[model samples]
Target: MRTNSPETKKTARELRNDPVLSKEYTKNKIQFQNYYFKLGYQWSKPDLNSIVCRFAVLIQVIRIKREELTESFIEYDTRFLGGNFQIPDSKELLLLIFLNAPLYQVFTTLRKCSKRKEKYYKDRVGQRFEIQIGYE
Candidate 1:
């Protein structure tokens, strides 16, 4: 649980607005303000509903209950979702797996979305436009 303060947010704003860092951050699409709050020790509990709302915009991501998370939770979730287990000898590695689980899904979903083709048709006469008509 990270804590955020107004002073910290102001500092982050300055850093994010810096020319060099701002370019790099924009190129990487890194939200410095968000990361600042996440790393801040005084930040409040994350809003799970916000995650869901973002997902509703075709983000294809979701946050599980914090109670449902554990070090080995990622491995367990992978097995549950894929019906298999990964053989890892290190317990530490197993614990770290959960933290990155969302990453795998997020990348995969983004790739899939990118590869999809948008369908279009000619409505009347040689005019290309999208249509929303009866499926019958």
Candidate 2:
């Protein structure tokens, strides 16, 4: 799924945000994939990664491991280092571990983005997902 790992060491924002921080790479630290770090932080979101990593192992899934979360499996099984994912899905739910969203914000980013019509939702504390179809 990720072929770009070997060619480029860091993501666009990492290079753009600060040229100086890249020097840390020279220290030979464990290398994580570009996609799975914290927003605005060149660091890995371990809690987030742990959720995916653990679940994957529990379900016996994934190419990367929980400890390293490396970019890829190197020749002779060396492994690159860290590998979190930057994709939208990774940021979501335990249903937020998968959705990266609160129940309300899944439809819209704003918590209060949608307001139910008073006529339809006046006193319905609990409602089903079904939408009513008007009579022809």
Candidate 3:
């Protein structure tokens, strides 16, 4: 698990020091805070390892004008796998394909809500299983 490594600290410090990036971060943080707070929820800093480590499910939070929102999982890499966790490449690929399939999307959408408009944001809120790809 890569948590608070020297490189991560350095990048975080750089982001904090950059005026433009800092401003954008603060703005987004505030928006997230406000939205969560309305639901009687408080935001906490995500675990560093969880951000950099582990395979995760990704869901679309925002809807496009004329597109369907689908659910997907991140691809796992052996190089990034550490400790006891072992996920095969083929398994990961299959999982991704299944999760992103139209059938799975329809199933999840149906299970979540009956309203067509509300389906988009059904599983989109709160903490999601999302992979943190690359450095910010």
TM-scores of the models, in the order given: 0.19, 0.13, 0.20
* Residue-level lDDT tens digits of model 1 in 11-70: 889988897665433221111112111111122544433321111012222323334445
Q: Rank the candidates by TM-score, best first.
A: 3, 1, 2
lDDT of 3 by residue, 1-136 (tens): 3567998888889998997776443221111101111112123644443322222223433323211322221112112222122333221111111132222331011112224534433444332332223342
Per-residue lDDT, model 1, residue 118, is 15
- Which is the leading candidate under lDDT? 3
Cα lDDT, model 2, residue 26? 32
Model 2: CA > 4 A from native: 1-105, 108-116, 131-136
Residue 131: error of model 3 in Å?
27
Cα error, residue 109 of model 2, in Å, equals 11
lDDT measured at residue 7 in model 1 versus the true structure, 0 to 100: 82
> What lDDT does model 3 reach?
0.30
Query: Candidate 3: RMSD over Cα atoms?
Result: 17.6
User: Residue 127 lDDT in model 3?
Assistant: 24
